[model samples]
Target: MIAEPEPGTTAEPEPEPDPEPGTVRPGGRTARVRTAVLRVAGDVLAEQGFAQLDLADVARRAGVGKTTVYRRWGSVTGLVADLLGDMAEQSLPRTETGSVLGDLRANAALVCRTLADPRQGALFRAVIAAAACDARTAEALRRFYEVRVAEWAPCVEQGVARGELPVGTDAGEVVRAVSAPLYYALLTSGVAPDAAAGERAAAAAVAAARGGVFVG
Candidate 1:
């Protein structure tokens, strides 16, 4: 027979319970793996550009199995598309200030901050370059902008509802107008927009909206 522990000794602690399957908890192993892979992908895109992106290199950097990477994302374009989707999902929600101008300014400021970030700026540049040559990348890029615009368009709609802007103002167009100059500055002059530029862009959109320029 096995001997019992001493009277004064404590018994070993029981093992922790396992979580239910098909129920993904945040910060779990699966989430960690995804986080690691995406981080490595972003790093590579920022440092080497899209031209140098390879699944093998990404798997090596992520410390994940090549098979896993291939199974999860079949091709380079697929990986990039998933990355954009993740970015859209994780992006901050639109701010709802009392006034449409305030909301637009908040949106403009968010765009300016993202474009001014070093890694983000480089990543976007790489993606844009890739999009110029790859149809899949172009479509993914288009979807990303569409998501962002849809998120902010409600603010313009609210402006019209509140009588701040003319009736029938095109919400999507106004939202796009606020971001157009900022992106233009980045793509053309290679200048990341500053807070002042963001404010100017917001103000210009508001002016145009009030002038019924975006009326449908």
Candidate 2:
């Protein structure tokens, strides 16, 4: 008879096989792994910026297999793209408050809150910086803002429909105007905007819209 294996001498378990890229379903092990990996990726981006992000480091930090990360994301730019996609997917829908000013104020408040959060602010700065040099990341960042701007454009359109604003007002431009100054402040001053600044942004956008500045 063969001798039994010695205690504490069991063979190491095999590493899990990499899942087919884009074939993993949601709300199971795959979802959990994605969530964990993205969270770690965001943390790294927030703390160390994009130049320092590495798939192997992210996998190790996330407690995921390096092969899995490599197979799924393929590169730093790919991972960053997925991270931006996830952020766009998870952003809150626009709030409706029955008036253009109220809705715009709500949008401004949300933008301010996001930028004011230390981790989130840093993450955005890092991503924006990365976008300046990486084409894939730049496209991803553009898509993220496109998603956000689209979500808020309805507010301006509704205001025009209600005759509160001039006809032919460019809804997308009006919506973008509200956040432009807030973002400018942050980027220029390295300071998160406060609530008062949000109010000013909303009011300024509304005033501009009312003045037909955004009319095409």
TM-score of each: 0.86, 0.89
Q: Write the per-residue lDDT of candidate 2 for residues 37-118, one digit (tens) a residue.
A: 8999999999999999999888888877677778879999999999999999899999999999999999999999999999
| Candidate 1 C-alpha lDDT tens digits along 1-216 | 112245787432232243465576787756665677788888899899998999988877887666666776788998898788889888999999989999999999999999999999889988998999999999999999999999999999898999999999999999999999998899998879999999999999999999999997
Q: Can you list the residue pairs that collide in candidate 2? A: none
Candidate 1 lDDT score at position 23:
74
Which residue pairs show collisions in model 1?
Answer: none
Instruction: Please give the CA lDDT of all the candidate structures.
Output: 0.87, 0.91
TM-score of 2: 0.89
lDDT of 2 at 42: 98
